[model samples]
Structure formats: structure tokens, C-alpha cells
Target: MVRLSRFVRQTFLSFVAVSCVVASAPSHADGTAGWESVKEAGVLRCGAAVAPPYVMRDPKTGEYSGFFSELCRNFGQNVLKVKVEFVDTTWDNIVAGLQSNKWDLSMALNDTPEREKAISFSAPATDYNVSFVYNRNNPKIAKGAHSIAEIDKPGVTVAVMSGSAQDKAITAVFKQAQIMRLPGNDETRLALMSKRADLLADANTTNMLLTEAHPDWAVAIQPNPPLAQQEVAFGIRKDTPAADIAVLNKYVSEQVSSGAVNRLIKTSVQSMLASNK
Candidate 1:
């Protein structure tokens, strides 16, 4: 009986030791599996949609530039210690691609409640607002039009990048005006410039560039209450661990605090201007 009791005690001790070892082992199940996979791959994939000053891609070289791309490169290199790959995408498919795991991150996504339902976001890198740009000489748009209502009239055609936040915003507000959903920024701008569209609905920053490019005719509506004001941040998979998001937030906060983001934006704007010239 003493020998049997000794064997039973030894078995229980061994079982407990094994359990402790399993419990203490690092878990990939804690929602950090995404980060683990990224680390294992040794490359962080960032989805890039061409939104000037936020993201830009060179047609000749296929190289990505602009603030968001630079930020993604920095995060992958400095924080994740991985090679960064820019996955070309369009605004229409940016969110869908992220959902499908085509990339680890989506750069310069506006954090809307609708998007929140689909994916999570890091802390905002910058504030964003939609604005309408039009040729001041166009008869469809009134001079000094201060509100969307002033422009939302019959025969007025508003052009926007398909599946963009601005497209959604203008679609919601413009009841009588025709909405032209083009596939790319260049197309939308061309629609406006060619007078096929009376107004171009896009980010205020983007409109600023357009207006600057054609100051003689381009005019951006400065609405008193702004339009679709929101936070622009990096998009991540919904299943990404909150801890991983916290790390990204910390990095974004540090960049914003140090004015690094502002500098990047300035550089991007300058580069865009130089390219246009």
C-alpha cells in the first residue's frame, strides 16, 4: 500500500509539472497570431491605394511614395523589423483585400463606423474631411457656394473616385445632382476638368492640390460645418490582437507628437507638386 501510494503521488506531480509547462508556453491563440505570422514571413505587406499626399504610386517604377507609404515602410522596418511590400490596390477593394488577407495593413483608411463593422483601426494619423472642387467658371456651380445644398441641384454632375469615402458622402447628400463614380483619382479629376462632371468630390487635401494646379478656375467649397469629417488611420484585420493595435497606436502617437507625420505630409505634397510640374 505504501508503494502504491508513492506511485500515485509521483504520477500526480508529473501531471502537474506537464500542465504548468503547457500553460507557461507562449500562445499564438491570444489574437496575436496575425503578428506572429507576419514575423514568421519576414515581410509585412501594406495595401496601397493611390490617394495623393496619403499614398502615391509611380506608374513607371511601380514604387510607392507619399506619407502613408512612408509611414508603412517605417513601421515595418523599425517596429516589426521586417521587409515591407506595397501591395497595389484600389479604394474600391482596399477593405476587401484586407479582409481577404491580401495584405497585413491598409494605409490611409478613413475610420468610419461602417468600416469599423468590417475591420479595426490604429490610432488616427490625421483628420480628414471631404470637399467639392469645381471650375469657378462653370455655370452649374454658383460662385462662392458655401454649402453642399448650393451645389446639389439638377444638371450638376459630381465626380468621385468609386468606393471612396467621399463618394459615399456625396452620394448621401446629393439628391438631384448626378454622381459620376470613376475608378481612379485621375479619372475623376479628368471628368471634372473635361466638364463631363461639374464638381469633383474628394479629400480636402486632394482638392487643395487640384485648386493649386489650376488656380485660375478650380475652386474648393469651404463649407462651414465641413463634410464627412473623420479620422484617417491604418486598417488592420478585425482579428488582430488588441495588443498589436496598441503597439501601432503607440507608434502613431509618437509620430504625431514628434511632428513626423506632418513632415511626411509636407514632403508628399511637395513631391506631388514637383511631379505635376
Candidate 2:
């Protein structure tokens, strides 16, 4: 009788264990719980901060555009079969917004070790590096300055967008120079134009736009090895399933491999230049 009781108890325990495992398993075979939630809602929310060529918002019409935003819209409408919503945010809160579930993806975030601890990233849409933009005739900067050390000296001031990757990078490297952190890209560019700052530290591509806008005065220099050389990717919550990330990765890979990303960038640049003119 005791042997019979023991057998029954063992069987019950086994059944319970199996039930628990089944309950814990993802409902979908793809392991796309997060994505499923997004699909159910019928909208893919993308967090955006205005970093030109990456993210841009029209001041008058409140429309969102730029390469990354375009990718977001395309991925949502075409790949996920949903509507896209751009949630305006600042660089300081872009990652936090993703963490809090305020948005499904943070657009155009630079994937770095510091951010990886808090959130996951999709495959890179493009490479990113920091460069310094300054007036070619500026007496503070050397005629042929190619290294950061030449710019990192007392009495020289460098302007960067507040709470941006370039801000953090230049802060670490420029011990002797004053780092003037502004709230936005326009503010930083205006600082350089007004002589409030001597150097504008920003993304290499962004500085390219600045130089193009003011070719007579603005010129950019990329450091030899590069600063904050990293990948710009979409930021998602850390708990996001690998399958969901894979979907994003595949889409980004397709765009990059087919040269679609380059076309988007060119279009954005041309639009920006035309507006400036």
C-alpha cells in the first residue's frame, strides 16, 4: 500500500512540474511575446529625438522624417503590418522611455556598452563616429589640426548637444577644454556660429551637414582612430525576446545590404540642404 501511495505522489508531482513548464513556455512558437503585444495594439511606437539625418521633426506640421524614422515607418507598415507612431522625446530620456514601455523602439540610438546594460539593440543600421567642426580660419584651432589633443587645451571651448553620445565622449577626452553642453543641435551649431564656442563636437555625419551649410567657415576633422566609433541601431527593452530582435535585425540587414539605407540618407541630406538654402 505504501509503495502504491509513493507512486501516486510521484506521478502527481511530475504532472505539476510539466504543467508549470507548459505555463512558462511562450504562447507562440516564435517566442515573440513582445512583438505579439505590439501587433495586438496595431501600432509600433518609435521614440524619436531630433538628431538630423537620423531623426527630424517638422516644426510646422509636426511630421517626423529622417533615415531612421523612415526605417521605423517602413518596418512597421511593411514588416510588422501595423501603424507607426513617433513619440517625441529627448536624448536624455530616449533609453528610459524604452525601459518604461513608453515606446516600442528608440530610434537612432548609438549602441554602446553603457546602454547595452539597460536595453538591447537591433543590428546596426549604420556606423557612427564623432568629429569636430570648427571655423577654418579660427585662430584657436591649429591650421591642420587632425588630433583631439590639439583641440583639448585651456581657453578653447567645445560645444556639444546636451546628453548626447558626443557630449559624453568629448567630456571624457577633453580634460583641459571647456565643454559647453547645449540642449539641442541647433543650439550647439549656433554657439559655434556666434563664437560662443570655438569647436562643435558632434557626429561625423551631422558635422558634414554643418560644413555643407556654411562651407566658407565650417570644416570638420575626424580624429585618426575615431572617437566613440560605434553602431547606430534601434533600441528595445532588455527583456524583448530574441525572435523579435531577429525580425528587426533581418529588416535592417535587408535595407543595408540593398543600399536602401544610403538612399534614405541622401534624400534626407538633400532635403536638409535645400531647406537651409
**Model 2: per-residue Cα lDDT over 1-277, one tens digit each:** 1133423343344334323322122322332336677777788889998989889889999999899999999999998799999999888888887888788899998877788889877777888899999988889999888898998999999999888889889888888999999888889989999999999998899889989988888989899878988888899888776556666776787798799999999999888888789
Clash pairs detected, candidate 2: none
Task: Residues 1-277, candidate 1: write the lDDT tens digits.
Answer: 1133423343344334323322121232232336557777788889998989899999999999999999999999998798999999899999998888888899999888788899987777888899889888888788989998899999988899999999888788789999999999899989998999998999998888888877888899977678888878899988775456566776787787799999999999888888887
- lDDT score for residue 63 of model 2: 97
The residue-level lDDT of candidate 2 at 6 comes to 28
Superposition error at 239 for model 2 (Å) = 1.0
Model 1, C-alpha of 269: deviation from truth (Å):
0.5
